[model samples]
Target chain A: MVVGLAAGFAPAAVADAYLDMIEAETEKIAGPLPTVVDGEAGAESEEDAGFQEFLAYLKEESLGSYTFFEKLTPAQRSEVFERHKQGASLEQIREIIMERFLKR
Target chain B: MRNCVGMILGLACLMQPVWAEEVKVGEADSEFAVKLTEDTDYLHVVHQGKSVKVQRVQDPNYELRGYFAKTGRKCPPFCLQPMHADPAVTSVGEVEVLEFMENELRDGQGFLIDARTPSWFQKGTIPGSINMPFTVLSKGEDDPEMAAALEQFGAKRRGPVGAMTKTLEGWGLFEAEQKTAAWDFTEAKQLLLWCNGPACGQSPRAVRGLLEVGYPADKLFYYRGGMQIWQLFGLTTVIPDA
Candidate 1:
C-alpha cells in the first residue's frame, strides 16, 4: 500500500535536494521519532518542540510569509500527519511533497 | 525446492525499456500572441502532470474545469491574468493597444503612475509617470509620513488601523496594490497602473486597491500591457525619479 502511494508521488531530481534538507531539519528537531511515519508527523506535531520553536523563529524572521501548512497540498498535508503516527522517515514524507505538489 | 526456486526468480528483476525525451512547457500555437476569437471560451492545457482545463467564462480570468490524471488541465496558458471565481477584469491585446496609449496620453485621457518600490521606480518607469510607491499604503496607520501623504491625496482616514489594509488584503496584497494604485486620478482623468505585464499581478493588485478607495471603475483603465508592452513598442521610458 505504501509503495503504491509512493510510486504515484515520486519527487523530481531538482526538488529532492530541498526536500531532503527539510526532512533533516524537521528530524533534528523532532528527535528519535518513528522512521516509518516520517512526513508531516515529524514536521507538524510538538513531538519535536525544539523544531516547532525553530519553525516559529523562521516564520517570524520571514514576516509570516513562510507557511508550512499552506505550502503543502491537502494530500501531502494529511500524509505528514499520518507519518507522525507511523513514525516514518522524514525523507519518505518529503518525497511525497516534491512529487505530489511542487513537481506538478 | 519449488518455493525456493520461486523466491529466487522473484528477486531477479530487469530495467524496463522506455523512451527518454524532454517535455515542453506549453503548446506551440497557444504560446504565440494571437487575437483570441470571442467565441473561443476555453483553453485546454495539455501537460504531463495534473492536466489543467481552464474555461474562459470571462476574458483573461479563467475557471478551472477539471484536474485529470491523464490529459487533465491543471492551469491555463502562460499563467496569464489570475483565475478568479469572479473575473472582474478582462484581457487586452498587446499589439492593438498602441493607438489607445497614444490617444489616451495625447488627449490627457489618463495619468500613468508607477507604484512599485522606490528602488524599482528608480530603475525605470513608464514615460511621464510620477513615482508614488505603494509601500506608503501598506505602512501602519500611525506612520506619520504615510498618514501625511494620504492626507495630501485627499484620502479619508476613518479607522486608526492602516487605511489601505482593507483594500490591500482584498486584492491579494502585492499584485492588487500595484493594479489599484495605478487608478489614482488625483491629477489626471484616468489612471494607468502597471508593473510587469501578463505574468505579473502587482499592477492588478494596485488597481483593485484604487477601486476599494472609492475610485470610479469607468475612470480606471489597467494597462494589462505594462512596462513589457512599453518596452516592446520601441518607446523610451524615464529611469526612476528622472
Candidate 2:
C-alpha cells in the first residue's frame, strides 16, 4: 500500500525530496551565519557621525565650498576625509577637491 | 532735367555694392588681418547671461599653450577617432560649426554639446557649448539622470505600453524611426557634439549612447576636431563658472 502511494506521487515528491536534500547539504557545508554585535553597530554609527561632523566643518568654514564638495565622488570624499585626518588645511583640502572635481 | 539726372544718379549709387567699404575678414591689407572666413569676422553668442564675442586671436604672434597644445597622449584611451561618428551622422569642420552657431544654435533649433566631463568643462570650453558628459549619457536610458537628460534634449517618455501598442510597434505599422519602446524623439533638438579632439572618444561614446536610446542619426553632428584643433587654430574658449 505504501509503495503504491509513493508511486502515485512520484514526480513532484522526488523533485521536492531532491530540493530538500540539496538544502540540507548546503546548510551542512555552510554553518550558521555570524551575528552582528552591538559594538560593530556602534562603530558604524560613529563613522556616520564623524562624516556628518566633517560635512558640518566644511559647511561652516567655507562659504561656497560645500557646494563643490557635494559634487565629489565617494572615493574623492574618502580622500578628503583622509586628508582632513592628516591635518591638511581647509584651503589645501578645497584645492584637492577642486582638482579631483575638474579631472573627473 | 537736373532733377531727373539726380534721381538716376541716386539709383545708380543705391545699386552699387554697399559692402565695398565694409572691411571683410582675411582681406589682403588690414591691421587685424586674422579672420575666420572671407565674410565672418566674429560670432556673437550669449554665455552665462553675457554676450560673448567669439573670434580668432588677432595677435599674429599668439600661440596655444597648456594642456590642449600637448601632441601625444596614451593611445588606449586617447586613440584617434574616425571622421564620422556614425554613417548617418554628418562630420563637420569649423566653418560648418560657425554656420551652425549662426543659424541653428542662434535660432534655438540646435544645441552644441561639450561631451567631456565637467572638470574639463570648468577649465575651458568652446563658445556656445553646454557640457553634457559622456559618462552621464552612457548610464543607459533607464537611469533617472539619463532619462532627465533625454527629456532635456526633447525626448518624451511613452506611457505604459498596452498589448495593441506593442503589437503595432512590433509590426511595421507604427512610425519607428523617431520612436523607441520607451521614448518619442520627434521633437528632439539637433545636437552637435565635440570633445577633446579627434583622439578623444568622449563625443563618440556620447553619440553611441544617444543612438542606443534611439536618437535620430540625421539630427546628430560630430565635430571631430574638438578643443585641441580649435585651440590649434587660435579659436576662442571660455572658462565656465563653478
Candidate 3:
C-alpha cells in the first residue's frame, strides 16, 4: 500500500516541480502573477484611455484632490475601464466614477 | 630619540580632523546626505554565509529603453502613490536607502526589499536589495506559498487565524522561559520596501499586504523614490548573476 501511494504521488510531485521551474523562468522575464486576488477588486481594471485621461486631469487639480481610483474595488475599476473603452467621454466617466465611488 | 618620536606622533594625532568626510547626494538642497565608512568600490554583505558583493557596475551593456523609459502611463492602474504609502509609514529617498544599503543591510539588521516582479528585478535593481515580489505575500490568506514564506521569515502563528496573534521569532532571550511561547515582535527584522518609484504601486501594495498580515507599521519603510528616481540620479544598480 505504501509503495503504491508513493508511486501515485510521484507524478504529481514531479508535475508540481516542473510547474515551479517554468513559472520561475517565465516570471524572471515577464512579471509577477496578475491576480485580481493580489489585493482587492479595482486592481485588475483594464486600461481605459478616457478614464485614465480623466484621472490624469484630476491629479493636476491642485487643491485637495481625492484618490478617486482607489475608491472602487478592482472589479468596479475594470468596469469603468470597459465603459471608457466603449464610447464614454471624460465627463461621463468622471460622473460615473463620482456617482459610484465618491463618498456622499 | 624614541621619546621625541612618540611626542611628535601625539602632536600629529591632535592636529587630525575630528569629523569624517561628508557625503552629498545628487540633488542640491534636499536634506538627506550621509557619510559612509570610508569610500570603497563595493558594499560587502553576507547572506546565509555566502559573501555577496553589492557594487555598482562601472559600465553595463544594457540601456533603459521601452517601458521604463516611457514617462507616463494610464493613471488608474499605473497611478502615482502619495509620498507616504500610509499615514504611519515612512517615506525615504535614495540617500537614506544608500545608507541602509551600506550599513543596516551590511550588518544584517534589515532587508532592503525590491518589490518588483522577477522580470524587472532581473533587468536591474539597487545594490544590496533582494527581490520579494509583492504578489507572493499578497496571496490569499490560506495560500500555502504565503504560509511557507511567513514561516521562513521566522514568524510563528499563535491562537486562531482571524483572531490570531503572531510574533517575530529570534534566538533565545535573556530568560529561558521567554524563548518559545509567542511570536516576538521585538526581534522582527526591519524591512525597506521599494518598487518602480512614485509612479509604481507595486511596493505600496506589498506594504499594504504586510500591514494586513499584522507586520508592525514602524518596522515597514517605503523607499518612495524607487528605480525611476534611482536611475534619475544615476545611482548604482547591480545585475544578479543567473
DockQ of each: 0.01, 0.01, 0.01
Runs in model 1 deviating more than 4 A are: A1-104, B1-80, B83-109, B137-188
Reference-based lDDT, residue B25, model 3: 41
Candidate 3: where is the Cα deviation over 4 Å?
Answer: A1-104, B1-42, B45-67, B159-184
Model 2 residue runs over 4 Å out of place are: A1-104, B1-25, B28-32, B161-175
Steric clash pairs (candidate 3)? A41-A73, A41-A74, A41-A75, A42-A73, A42-A74, A43-A74, B167-B183, B167-B184, B168-B184, B197-B226
Taking the tens digit of each residue's C-alpha lDDT, what string does model 1 give over A19-70?
3432332222222211111223212333434545434543565432235544
Worst 10 residues of 1 chain A by lDDT: A29-38
Model 3: share of true interface contacts reproduced:
0.00
lDDT of 1: 0.42
Q: Rate the local accuracy (lDDT) of all candidates.
A: 0.42, 0.73, 0.58
- How far is each candidate from the true structure, as Cα RMSD in Å? 26.7, 21.5, 26.4
Please provide TM-scores, in order, for all candidate models, with all chains considered together. Answer: 0.33, 0.60, 0.49
Evaluate model 3 with DockQ and give the value: 0.01
**Alpha carbon deviation, residue B60, candidate 3 (Å):** 17
Q: Where is the poorest 10-residue window by lDDT in model 3 chain B?
A: B29-38
lDDT of 3 by residue, B92-139 (tens): 886678677656665556788888778677676665678888777666
Candidate 3, residue B156: how far the Cα is off, in Å: 2.3
* Candidate number achieving the greatest TM-score relative to the actual structure: 2
